[model samples]
Target: MRIRAAEEPQPGVKWIDEGGARMKFLEVDDNTIDVNCDTWASCEDELHARHLFIRWAQFACCWSQGMMASKMIN
Candidate 1:
């Protein structure tokens, strides 16, 4: 699949499902991305977020080639 930025692109973070039950977040037009465990994926209903916690950050930068990824099962 092909992923493209918005028409008028701005610095932001985007989450996506990368098949095989794998999930990830991609940073667009940004040098770095900060993803804390307090984000919306915090609900206990999301099995992937269960181990994550508030103020918990895994990676530092999420550049185009770089990835801040997660998994979602439904």
Candidate 2:
């Protein structure tokens, strides 16, 4: 599985793809993000969406911490 910043069509986007499942993220504000997902192999799109949001939140937390540490060191 791989996750990366998305380009084009929208700004402040993130995406993840893991074979059968795919997810997208859109930053609504500094503290909020909207997550969308489609799990073609499963019937629980809602559950997948929640999972994607959690993963993105984890990534965002780590990313923000890294940026803060970088700023402090510089």
Candidate 3:
């Protein structure tokens, strides 16, 4: 799967391939985008795959919490 890097990606933005498979990021940051690449590759429970997923989840959750805090502060 090829992912185009972005500076600030909108929510629900996805990439649909010819096979009709879509992958969207939950959130994006300055450096990377947090996307659900579960089915992007046929990884049958590999350690690296799991680590990537965990990192994405962590990034998403951290962004969400930061946004919430900013909203509360403002």
- Report the number of the highest-TM-score candidate: 2
lDDT, model 2: 0.61
Query: Model 3, residue 52: what's the lDDT?
Result: 53
What TM-score does candidate 2 reach? 0.43
lDDT per residue, candidate 2, 24-58, as tens digits? Answer: 88889986667675544332467766776677578
**lDDT for each of the candidates?**
0.36, 0.61, 0.56
RMSD of each: 16.3, 12.3, 13.0
Question: How does candidate 1 fare on TM-score?
Answer: 0.16
Cα error, residue 34 of model 2, in Å, equals: 17
Per-residue C-alpha lDDT of model 1 across residues 1-74, encoded as one tens digit per residue: 23555334544523333312223545655565433322344243454454333222432233222542432221
Evaluation by TM-score, superior candidate among 1 and 2: 2
Could you tell which candidate, 2 or 3, scores higher by TM-score?
A: 2
How much is 56 displaced in model 3, in angstroms? 0.6
Shift of residue 11 alpha carbon in model 1, Å: 35
Using lDDT as the yardstick, the better of models 1 and 3 is 3
- Full-model lDDT, candidate 1: 0.36
- In the range 20-70, model 3's lDDT, one tens digit per residue, is 235567656765556553334443347655765675678668867996798
